[model samples]
Target: MPTSASAFEIQSDFDAIDFAGGMIAEAKRRTGDNAAIEYACADMFDWLARFPEAYDCILTVGTLHHVDLTSALRAMSRALKPGGRLLVLDLVRRPGWRYVLINSIVWDAPASFVDGVNQIS
Candidate 1:
């Protein structure tokens, strides 16, 4: 369930679906309320399935590094209609023993070893 669709699009155009809460809110606040401004506080995966063929270009940036990337992406792919475009930008890292060690050290950075405080806290 991999997807190329995104909420944070790189390009702004007529085909772009601005799937962002912060942007939507900022627009309303700055522009003094425009009626054409459409916004939703919804999950991306759930939203895609609801409107399969409504969009053409999709963009997702820097999300896979946070949560269950596989499950989220799979659902997004299914949501897309045929020929729809998707773009995914994430901090891709090699999965290995070395990766695990480096992440353990830097994820709780400024201290190489945190006296197991990283594990406990």
Candidate 2:
């Protein structure tokens, strides 16, 4: 990973933003590096639309499925600088009970946590 880069994390949910803040803090504490990271509680489309070609990279996790994929991708493309990267991690399939149970056991996660993974779609 590059030693220095600007990162913006956008999420409309306050809880998700809070969780990300905690994770960022933990990461900084462990790595002992102060990375430039900005957290914005805004709808992804609105934020991206405001920053045309402003971001070096755009990444979304478990979010695109909830919106119009084509529009979302276009917005991301506009937001990213030339040669910038876009990475998206989303649910490709709805998890069955068996898959959920196995994931819960393998990750040592609670039933609720596993269930929430199902909602990503």
Candidate 3:
């Protein structure tokens, strides 16, 4: 775990999505003998499809709220090797007061939208 943390780092950037390495042009900067880091630009969904093993550790901050949580977590599970650790701290279904507070913000959405939110929760 500590081995990969400081030795090398990969950071991805995309206009459409925030992720690791993106295009030939940008990745070219980090490739060849001059390459200090490998740059890859690919979607997480597609990327995970290519790797069937688990990761040593997966870190997600508040980002998972953008996608359907179940699907995302399943994908993460698929990519994770056995005993892989996935650490995530994101939005949660708040019971009582917090739930009411969040509902208030989405009150303007159509009823079906509200239902969809509930389903996702």
Candidate 4:
């Protein structure tokens, strides 16, 4: 990411938008006001569907599991230019003992931590 590049950060959840907005503000502040990022509270599907082939790259972190994965991928692909890159970082479910172990550990976790985990799961 360049200091002069234009970026859009859109989140379907309103609460998540505040976090993104704060991060962008902090980045701009640290970089002496050169980072150009726009934040929005909107559904990714609806927003991405409007801008066909408009973006050179699309990046999604820890968000895909919350919605319809197939549709989300299609929308993201449609919104990107030819040969554009799509970067995704998210959690995947583990089966058997791994799942059991994770559930056991989370059972004893702090209330706040467990709440966060539940939201993502």
Q: Which model, 1 or 2, shows the larger TM-score?
A: 2
TM-score of each: 0.46, 0.50, 0.45, 0.52
Which has the greatest TM-score? 4
Which is the winner by lDDT between candidate 2 and candidate 3?
A: 2
- What is the per-residue lDDT of model 3 for residues 71-112, given as tens digits with 9 covering 90 to 100? 666676676666666656565565554334233332232222
Off by over 4 Å in 1: 1-23, 27-37, 92-121
Give the C-alpha miss distance for residue 97 in model 4, angstroms. Answer: 18
Model 3 residue 67 CA deviation in Å: 0.5
The whole-model lDDT of each prediction reads 0.49, 0.52, 0.51, 0.53
TM-score of 4: 0.52
Displacement of residue 26 (Cα, Å) in model 4 is 8.8
Question: 80, model 4: CA deviation in Å?
Answer: 0.6
Give the Cα RMSD of candidate 1: 14.3
Worst 10 residues of 2 by lDDT: 10-19
- By lDDT: ranked, best first: 4, 2, 3, 1
Q: What range of 10 consecutive residues in model 1 has the weakest lDDT sum?
A: 108-117
Better of 1 and 2 by lDDT: 2
- Write the candidate numbers in order of decreasing TM-score: 4, 2, 1, 3
Clashes of 2: 0
CA RMSD of each candidate after superposition: 14.3, 12.3, 11.2, 12.9
